[model samples]
Target: MTNIWEPIRIGRMNLPHRFAMAPLTRSRAQADGTPGELAAEYYGQRASLGLLISEGTQPSADGQGYPNTPGIYTDDHVRGWQRVTSAVHARGGHLFIQLMHAGRMGHPDNTAHGRAPVAPSAIAPGEKMFTLGGLKDAPVPRPLATEEVPATIADYRHAAARSIEAGADGVEIHGANGYLIQQFFSPNANTRTDSYGGSIENRARFGLEVVAAVVDEVGADRTGIRLSPGSRLGGIAEGEGHEAFYLHLVKELARFDLAYLHVAHGGNEELLRRIRELWPKALLVNRVNRPLEAATADVEAGLADVAPVGRWALSNPDFIERFRRGAALNPPDPQTFYGSGAAGYTDYPHLEASAASA
Candidate 1:
């Protein structure tokens, strides 16, 4: 039986364990889209995990969806992330910078330049977004012109290159959770009649193009993507053909021989099984809010090559150690999950510290 603690090879990096950290947005970056000073220490503390996927990082200025979210498009952003990469590497951990382009999810108040969020169509998600002012309704996004699609693809490719230059192991294109790529996949959000919308294949085109561009910039071995097949987040309603669309998308993605396909499981076991079959390489599954035992079972049952945990890993810096010894875990505090400080971010106690206090 494959143990969750066992080592595995993901791309060129050899992971010391099969438990990867899922990307969780903590909204802790500087106002200028640069990572905070303690970002390195925060990430390095969890370096024992097989993989440390960074929070959703924007590829361009307009990609900023939430306040203080980091970006990879600037020199300051590169330098800020260099510190994080060095710290993680010092502790023998591989890092993948998740490239998240929040299309219609952006509120102008949250952006640096107050640019209108762009998507496949001029549709608003009808969702509220966190901004500097306060929680506000998402504005109807300005639809990208046919000529502007290539520039968006270029942004992804540029960010992938920048991540590598900053010493990242790879980049995971964020196509999940009703972000830009997912916005294209969603029929309700994307009602365009262009080459990038309408039918299933057309909807899948933007994602495939982004992946292909990233693969070209970085090697296929260093490229991965996260997808939520049947997700209804951000007011998205795929209605019918959700499974068929994802199946087709996965089949197309497999052609590139990418590093891994990370799926945020949306309670569709049969659809997940089909994706696993279609994808012949590494597969990482994230079962949100599930216990450690369930994550271990996914790996042992061969349902996933690795199980990525979010909140558990966030609150437990020594998550691997705690799980190995069956020790107690520190409960995650929801109040401080997103903020600007060391209070809830890096203040979580490890096993030794907790034991000493006891």
Candidate 2:
């Protein structure tokens, strides 16, 4: 059997296949940042992907970054997501919400009450983000006071609890792509002299604390984390050298024995090998925009237990079947990627529909 089609055990969840839908941001939520009514339909359509990691969802009102992105903190938000989880479950797929806190990546205009974004230090990402208006420069975020760090950790914990209440199978902490947690790890974003900055251990402290808090609220078997070891997105530059910081961070986190560790495309072989050595459990790896041959080769080589596909899952609802049959893949339209409605969201056809048309 193809490695991608084989069953893999990730934590307590027995996945039917190694193909998962990687988290892709689609800003199609309500004005209040709650999930849209059609979210259930959207996720249910792609339920064949074994595991579906929902888009980056904010843990607090201030954590919102893009317009119309979902939140997991409020009552209405929980109710909205419950419907999504139920739909995916009915279709036999495991779903996990990717809890993301935007930090300096957020713009005041995009946030709930125009509140300034906050981070580990008083550093801005030195970039612009999409707001209700057009692209605008990121406002200088206030450094999260040392005393307030506990509250931020609580925010993640509460979000994890809410995710379980919403019937999600698990939660993936968004510790990648220069978001809040990644900001703490990057020296360019975090320059504080407190416990959350300075050395590699100190810089990784906030993320570790948040993970522990969430794991306490939700068991380690249901908590997942996504990391980009050497990514420089959102104006974040890893001045501390990616290999040292991530190596130390993964080694520390390995002790928790969480559900799984999902890594993005930028990690080096040595770092990945180190992670695999330390983390003796499930590992989900995303190949980003790489070709199918490269992705399949990586899976065949056992670099990752599961290989997640993002855009392919978005454009092809039956991505697994299409890949299994070696059929053509539907190209996703970049224009409708972040739109409001179902134009490019859930309208993508499955293999049966395509075959019937042909």
Candidate with maximal lDDT:
1
Instruction: Report the error of model 1 at residue 118, Å.
Output: 0.8
110-196 per-residue lDDT for model 1 (tens digits)? 876988999989989998988878889999999999899999999999999999999999999999999999999999999989999
- Give all candidates' CA lDDT scores: 0.92, 0.89
List candidate 2 segments past 4 Å from native: none
Among all candidates shown, the one with the greatest TM-score: 1
Model 2 Cα lDDT, one tens digit per residue, 1-358: 3476688888778888888999999999998877897899999989999899999999998789888999999999999999999999999999999999999898888866988989888877888889878999988998899999999999999999999999999999999999999999998888899888899899999999999999999999999999998888988899648788888898888889899999996847787877777777788888667788776766677778888889999999889889889898888999999965988898888888887988
lDDT of 1: 0.92
Per-residue lDDT of 6 in model 1: 81
